[model samples]
Target chain A: MKFLKLSMSATAFAAAMAASTSAMAEEYKMVILQSLTGGAAFIGKNVADGAAMAADELNANGFFGEGNSLVYEVADDATDRTQTLSLITRLAADEDVLIVMGPTSGSVALAGANVANEREFPVITTTNSMEVIENGPWSFILTQPADVTIPYIADFTAQTLGAKNCAIIGVKDNEAYVALQRKYEDLIQAQGVNLASVDGVALADSDFSALATKIATSEQDCVFIGTPAAQGANLVIQLRQAGLDPSIPILGHNAFASPTFIEKGGAAVENVYLMGAWVPGGYDDFSSAFSTNFEAKTGIPADEWHAVGYSGMQVIANAIKDAVAAGAVTREGVRDALGTQTDIPVVMGEGTYSYDEHRVPHFGMKVLQVKDGAFAVVGE
Target chain B: MLSQQILNGLVTGSVYALFSLGFTLIFGVQKLLNFAHGATFMAGAFIAYYCTISGLPFLLAIGFSMVATGVIAILVDLIAFRSLRKRGNAEFPALVSSIGVDLILVSIAQQVSKTQVLNFPFGTFPVKFYTFMGLRISLLQLVILATVAVLVALLIFYLKKTTFGRQVRAVATNERAAALLGVNAQSVYLQTFFIAGALAGLAGVLIGLLFNSMQFLMGEPYMLRAFVVVVIGGLGSVPGAIVASLMLGVMQSLTVAYLPSGLTDAIIFALLFVVLLIRPNGLFGDANAVAGGTRQ
Candidate 1:
């Protein structure tokens, strides 16, 4: 009889402890949607790492407050647009999910924006295209638009570099690069810069010999490369090998300001200029702190993609913090708070986060140059 | 500009000929297409790349890669084609089996390299240019042309002047008759596959050096072009493959130089379609592949 009484009391105590623990913690979910496999795996993996680090930091620091916890549900879209749409819809419908993080590629992000708008859920994307945000009110873009960055680059080429004849080579298969190339073509031609030649190559093509030969013979003062970092590096190296003047100005998109470019291009990338969103150590304290943490964790210096992803997580984390402060941590609450996020701390650059009516972040890129196999701010 | 483009085309065509010669030689002997030829090509470059990066001399690396890829090709035959041949399966089965092996090889490569585009360290080859008649050529290009020429001559000498070459030709003419005459058919297959793979491996290494990039998927595009080269040259005609390779290379170069960049592929394939329409047997293919003139 004494043993039975003890067991009953212990069961009662266990039940009470469970109830208290449950009441003490409130769970909010942040759904991370991005490509974890397929061709975009490199970018997607970095983005997911950044998001995971952000979540870990927030939970560890009690950023969500004493009685609150943030949970992450990661979904791999596999870099497919249809999969992105379906996953975004499913995440939006989940009652515990407060916000969605990304479908990092431009095409997938654009499709995801449609689902977010329909479900009235908030999404922050790391794609370079502004069209993703323009798709809906619930969308926020982390990277600066190509329209803003590309034109600035063209002007810089004309005004600062004093380039007369500019040659352009774009990867034709990529829609983002094509759009960027078209914009550059128009802007440079309009700026009275003589267009030497406009050429395009397939995405996986490594033999830029044919194109490099053309560019080398054209006598262009500068060459604009609108390909991905890997391909761009190949072009730059092959161009130099094909007997193009090493001192000739070579310019590239934001993607070129990456360790991959430097590592792959080796000595070829020295003096190559890039227009990108982040300049390492040039931004605020948060930028330095983020860089230190990222290098400590990843063992490599952060690139532009890492910056976009890290800043993307900061935007969502800040929104969640604001929602918890306001006593409303629902999806609607997070969405509204994110919409009103003016002066929210981010790691991309110095400016505080402010969103326009379309929720597109008004940010600009600074010019960066690769010197001694590292990215440094131009004119530094 | 045109002269320079043509020179560039010749350099590219030589590499294509080196790759296609192996593919055609295999098809000529067995009347089967080895889709895994491309994967074998890729493996050669990858092996050579690892060897070079691991501090081996470039020449030794090339030799090692060729031998390794040759062994791999023999294994491909043993695994993919041998069982089907024993079962008396049609040609299509061999094609399907080779594709499966190709996927397996490519997957292995992707895993090994982690899908990164690797480059030979700078100074693996010097960057020197020679200009003549207002057209520039690199020392690397000259070396490539010489390598291809020497390799082709060696292959021809091995096929035409050796006892094993006679056995291979006899087997190609009739497997049953060759077997009856005491020719070891299996050995012939092994020898042919080895030779073909070695040539492809060498071509892959050279192309990798030329482009300064090597990846698992790098073989895929070249494989597609190999099909065109072999088909246009007549499936199994070595001399025809060499000639057609040069022509296709010149055509591709001229198109890329003059036409809209997007239309380059379309135009090349269209040229292939026209060739097929005009010569269904390919330029040098046997009109009647069957010996003994169809059953009476």
Candidate 2:
């Protein structure tokens, strides 16, 4: 009778252990997908930072709810499309991650969208291009589209600045610049401002004296520069050297909104207007908090890309919280929660999120001008 | 528009001439197309920039850069090319060996200077405007043109008048015969490379100043253009290289100013193709010379 009683206890203990182990296995796993290495590291590092911070904040605050310990996994895509897809597949199948954030570049994000859609994992792309969300269902962009930023710039330049004629200069053979130039030209024309001329310069060409001279001699009131920081900085210096006054007003695309632009352009970049998704120095709380924490953590200035990255992470964390609250911790459930997200308070400062029509954020941009060698919010 | 384009071409063509003359001289004397020529040019620019940045006077920097490049060229020949000659390798093997040296030198440069464009600290050289009838030219272009002309004239005088230059010409024409006549062909070859490297180095310093940006990879573009100039100008002819450089530069400039930028490179290549079709051995090529044997 004693032996039977002992056997009954042993059986009960084994059953209880099995039940608890099975329950533990059902907990949600999150993956932070990013390009940690390569040419895009400048942007990728920030995105990774933002996601990690959000994860840390969420976990520490018990945002995943009581008794639900979230497991976070980070994967490097190396800014390669093939590797990005491979990483997504591995993370989805092996880790069984319910949600993911980023595959940084717009082009890489587009490729990641297809895999995310197939696996039912919601991926919040941090790139600003509209192409990321045009076809994918499980993808949502955290950055504002060119269409929104371009139109805003047109109105700002025409009405606020009272610019009558503008010259548009874009980098030759770059598809992104080509698309931006087309939108800019259309918007400028729509604003009743004369589109004086459109010039295409090669990326490697340092001699912009000829182009600058032509622009100076033209009837244009302002010049719109659409190139990366390196070429753009060179053009600005050359333009001024060739006797084109900075007082005439120079407007640039979002490409000119990086710290590299300021660092490279130096004093020459002063008084230039840039229309970007986030207003640098405008997000008082976010900027201050990020600067203090980021400098302490990484010993580097948290540029605009870092802000976008942090915002992307916040969005993902919110969706994860909503997913768990609704009792849908699976990939499909997390994706559904992210898809239904509305007005997520991102670090980019209070942006609305809607993937109803497409997986794109319809965030408005703030105009910032380089004043006294630093970006400051102008009359918006 | 056409005239402006031609002027642009002339400037570029002058650069091509400077590059090709060095390449042809090396090929003619050594029978080896020194692929490391580009690296020598790159080294020259780096040395010049380093010297200038370190507070050396501008002229001294140029002189130091040239001398440094010439020394490096001789070292390259001794360490890399000398082994192949000692081993009695075929012409192809010697050429291949030079390419290996080129790879090593280029990699060393790339590692030393991370792959970013270093801007040369060029304040404006005195700017003067010269008007010739309806055409206007800048002082910078005039300086470049005058320098090239003077260098070419000096090169011709040295080759015709100097005993060492005559020995160089003799070795280039017939290495075996020159050596049999106690002309010290090896020394002639070494001196030829030294002079050729100095010219290439000077060109690099000039180009770096002109573009205001110097990178490790900058040499490749000029090297390729030099090859085209050499092919079109006729191999082993310094005068031919100069003439072809001018023509090529004019063609490129015209294409850039008038035609769509996309078509510019295509048009330049098309002109090169036309030249090849008309004169397979090049404009100044010897009538009886075997095709593809000029360098050998």
TM-score of chain B of each: 0.95, 0.90
| Deviating ranges (above 4 Å) for candidate 2 | A1-129, A132-144, A162-165, A213-219, A243-248, A259-270, A278-285, A288-357, A361-364, A371-376, B1-117, B120-208, B214-228, B234-237, B248-250, B283-296
Give the 10-residue window scoring lowest on summed lDDT in candidate 2 chain A. Answer: A348-357
Recovered share of real interface contacts in candidate 2: 0.08
TM-score of chain A of each: 0.88, 0.81
Alpha-carbon deviation at A20 in model 1, angstroms: 5.8
How accurate locally, in lDDT, is each candidate? 0.80, 0.71
Give the alpha carbon lDDT tens digit for every residue of B253-287 in model 2. Answer: 55544455456557767777887899876787654
Question: What would you estimate as the lDDT of candidate 2?
Answer: 0.71
Q: How does model 1 fare in lDDT?
A: 0.80
lDDT of 1 by residue, A1-380 (tens): 99999999999999999889889887788888877654565566667777787787878888777767788877888778888988888887777788888887767888888888889888887676778767877887766666666886888888899888988889786556777888888888888899888889866678777777767776788999988677789999888876788878999977776677887888888889988766654366777788789889876667666777777777788888888889888877898888777776666644466666656675667788888877888776
Give the number of the best model, judged by lDDT.
1
Q: How accurate locally is residue A88 in candidate 2, as Cα lDDT from 0 to 100?
A: 81
* Candidate 1 structure quality by residue, lDDT tens digits, B77-172: 899998888777548999999999998898788767755677888889887889888888899999999999998888788777888877777777
